[model samples]
Target: MDMTTQHITLGAINMEAENPVELAAFWGTVTSAVPSVGGGTVYLPPAGPGGFAMFFRPMAGPRLERQAAHLDLTVPWGSRQAEVDRLLSLGATYKWDVLDEVPHVQWTTLADPEGNLFCVAEHPPAS
Candidate 1:
């Protein structure tokens, strides 16, 4: 048995949305991921090269509970503030800004419409 061989390929995102369509739309616009499947759960198709697929699952939870896990997005230098503002305009709420005072800088924290945290970072150049 090999460690690499035991790993299964699966990717998804859990969401608590009153309306899945609207929630999917919001994510779609932000990530440019289309809905690959619909009905019980909505799947957002993959984006450009190097991008991965996303799925939305209904969760029975409130919008204010703190999340132990979240998505971190990193924007290019000097782009965090602007991108944060843009996300705010597009149905996102500003939770708090985080920075590593010791290491200079790191990332900003933001949450989506469903209160799910995701970061808007500088798009890394394709290697």
Candidate 2:
């Protein structure tokens, strides 16, 4: 008997911004993944060889306030410092510094030019 079940998958995240291209590019730079343009929107594929992808949705006008939702990127363990330096070099402006409790380590809060928050830290090494 053929009982193979089909499955659906999540493609990406859609962000609302005045300038999709610019915003997308910022995320692309932050994540080091090229952004793809389609349907008048910018899309970021999964990070590294293969990962989760994100998309940008164009808002009709400027944002009235900060986005209620945000992104947090967890880098591989023991690589937070290095990742921080690399992202800074890539044009990710520093928004804040992370100080954790309980066997703590350093983390940096950064933002794209469009003001989207994303974090970089080394939690688990690349395989």
What's the CA error at residue 53 for candidate 2, in Å? 1.0
Worst 10 residues of 2 by lDDT: 98-107
Model 1: lowest-lDDT 10 consecutive positions: 97-106
TM-score of 1: 0.73
Instruction: Estimate the TM-score of every prediction.
Output: 0.73, 0.71
In candidate 1, residue 42 scores what lDDT? 82
Candidate 2 segments exceeding 4 Å error? 1-10, 47-50, 102-106, 124-127
lDDT of each: 0.70, 0.75
What global local distance difference test value does model 2 have? 0.75
The best candidate in terms of TM-score: 1
